[model samples]
Target: MTSATNPATEELTPFPDHTQLPDSDGTFVKNWQEHPQSILLTDSITPILKQLHPEGEYCIGQDLGIYWRLTDPPEKGAEAPDWFYVGNVPPLLDGLTRRSYVLWREFIAPTIVLEFVSGDGTEERDKTPWKGKFWVYEQVIHPAFYGIYEVQKASVEVYELIGGQYQLLSPNERGHYPIPPMGVELGIWQGEYQNTDLPWLRWWDLPGNLLLTGEERAEQERQRAEQEHQRAEQERQRAERLTAQLRALGVEPEA
Candidate 1:
């Protein structure tokens, strides 16, 4: 872990907690799609994460910072992934919402980090040491998987950390990147979400089933119930017709 130094004394003081860090850099989101994109990724994976961490020992950060070093201006040392997931850790620190992930205090690196490309994606792919996002995640944070999703191209590039370096992963037969840690795959789906029709990044199970959001799952259940009701109505009408046929043949139908 990189250490922070106080410029005044040239010595290390106690590292600041999440409370002391600047949560935001006062930078506006690059585009309108960023928020919805982040939400789509998070919403679809909530059920999978709950099943993975049944005791609620997990954290999901959407557009939140992971503080790796203590810099003069704290936000400079942090890289806020568009979306990230960490397991085996409490969702909240001391029963409070996490302002940001402080690495020194919480030693768990995220299981996966995803960056949504709003620009030409040079920043996400940049490999300059101590500065670039790719270099930091590969060397400092070292998540199991890192994904770059580009909406403009309707494509995603996933990398798996192997032997201390990120290996660009190839999609499987289903055209999705498999993440074994969570037994799920990452891929893009052309769909309408939040009233926006776009290619949204989503998750799938190992069996090639798309993970549905809460609303999607609800809609599925509603459709299933309607189908069952229709089947029952058809059965009732068939039984009534059979009774009428028996009456015409001069045989009373049993009650």
Candidate 2:
């Protein structure tokens, strides 16, 4: 639903300083209502999550705070990416825990950045609230791929940062972008993720096949095994019938 209560955070400011931020045991869902987009987009990436990190070593949601501080006193700095995926970093931030992803310390940049465009008036023309985010991610964070998905409508725009500039990445005929780093493609499919099938992002194999979720994969395996078992049983029955016919003909079957 929403943020889980942390007993450690007493008299909590809606926004806590980096140093004062409480330590979490790597649960990104905490305080999610305060930041719903983080959960929504992260959920959108579920099929690709394990494929991105089968070992669960390198990934961070918005709550981890891997964003540039844009505001004086850094109020705007809290504009975390909806969901960002980093490659090849320790699963945990420090040897202990991390409050926000500090660029200076980690020396790591997310390979992909996703933004959910809430229906704000100015977002249409790349105005104030939205432009600031783009500038920061492009100039400051410089994430390789930046994507924006609108919820109230059906539209997804992805950007690729190349040669010190952000360029609009066009989708193929089927509206999917091949992400070489993740070894798959991402697209806006009208399928379910987190029980809501509202244009979720899905991952595909190199041959452009949809990647299966853990549940879907298990179901596939079970179905395949059942098919194989049935085929083997049929073969055994055929062999027995043939052996019986040969013996009846007085031609002893050689096992």
Runs in model 1 with CA error above 4 Å? 1-12
lDDT of 1: 0.93
Off by over 4 Å in 2: 1-57, 70-75, 120-131, 151-154, 193-198, 247-252
lDDT of prediction 2:
0.66
> Which candidate achieves the best TM-score against the true structure?
1
Q: How good is model 1 by TM-score?
A: 0.94
The residue-by-residue lDDT of candidate 1 on 72-137, one tens digit each, is 788999999999999999888888899999999999999999999989999999999999999999
Writing each residue's lDDT as its tens digit, candidate 2 over 1-255 gives 899888797775454334543233343442222244455445435656567777776766663566355355443454466577887776664465556666655667889887666556144225344346676777777789888766656677778889977788888767788778877777766766555556655567667787665666788999999999999999999999999999999999885
